[model samples]
Target: MPGFPAAGPPGGPQRSSAETYAQVQASPEFAALRRRWRGFIFPVSALFLIWFLAYVLLSAYAPGIVNTRVGGSNITVGLLFGLLQFVSTFAIATIYSRFAEKELDPEASRLRAEVEDSL
Candidate 1:
């Protein structure tokens, strides 16, 4: 025990996982990152779910509406709505990517650097 390192390479004390987690959690940058993440995800998820449910409910209960033809083409309201699901998925993904790149990534990187420096 007198000659050996306690638990690490012996340059300094290694930080425990809990310590690192606590440090990150206490950081204002980390808190802001989490807030941005949840703020974007929750509202967008709720909106998408609501839109999807509306499409489903309307298709089931009001076929006359969704079945209506579009502009003399073979497409119908149902077709457009179905396509919109894919469109909305891509749109949300794009929006989130942009949001993360612009709003989240910088703070996240700063937090990461701080944690690494502390370690």
Candidate 2:
């Protein structure tokens, strides 16, 4: 078997998953997507993080609203805003899904094809 060149498996040590992924990512479309992600990913994540932090801070510091009554029970602006975050998160997800499907998906598919072809 040593001299026979023993077969390991499909997609073996001769070619790793990372190598395959790298090849995929190396495609023109994915390269562009990566570049676009470089431009958008961190900024979007950071903005949402800051937004969440702001919500928490407002919840903590905005005393007048925190003590206020709504329909005989208390519902602070902070609480309202914080709860709205879930809605905002869902909205963001929907928007991102649409964007990715419409814009990124086709490009990614082309990239994937390039990768596979290279292999």
Candidate 3:
């Protein structure tokens, strides 16, 4: 509530929901928003899945590499990699948050306001 924009007026023109939605869907702005979402989501999802799959495969089929000690430390390669998974997850979340804030939210807010004002 503190950070988000205030809502528009409650009452608006009495139009069919389908008509409003169709109008919005037909807008180029909506198309660009969808494209931006997919552009970020698809590649990030693919990369994370690949990384996870590699970790799983390594753990199952190549224990020697996964279990190897790092330097004189007690930490194993598997442990490091496992820890890195969490780090990467947080990093990606931060990146996405920044990206959405910078590139997506403003456009989405504009679209939302436009729809609300029309409604």
Best by TM-score: 3
Selected candidate, larger lDDT, 1 vs 2: 1
By summed lDDT, the worst window of 10 consecutive residues in model 3 runs over 1-10
Write model 1 residue lDDT over 82-116, tens digit each, in one string: 99999999999999999999999987777766666
Candidate 3 error regions (>4 Å): 1-13
Off by over 4 Å in 1: 1-12
What TM-score does prediction 2 earn? 0.68
Better candidate by lDDT, 1 or 3: 3
The 0-to-1 C-alpha lDDT of every candidate, in the order given, reads 0.83, 0.67, 0.84
RMSD in angstroms, candidate 2?
Answer: 7.6
Q: Each prediction's TM-score against the native?
A: 0.84, 0.68, 0.86
What is the TM-score ranking, best to worst?
A: 3, 1, 2
Quote model 3's TM-score. 0.86
Best first by lDDT, ranked: 3, 1, 2
Worst 10 residues of 2 by lDDT: 1-10
**What value of lDDT does candidate 3 attain over all alpha carbons?**
0.84
Q: RMSDs, each prediction?
A: 6.2, 7.6, 6.0
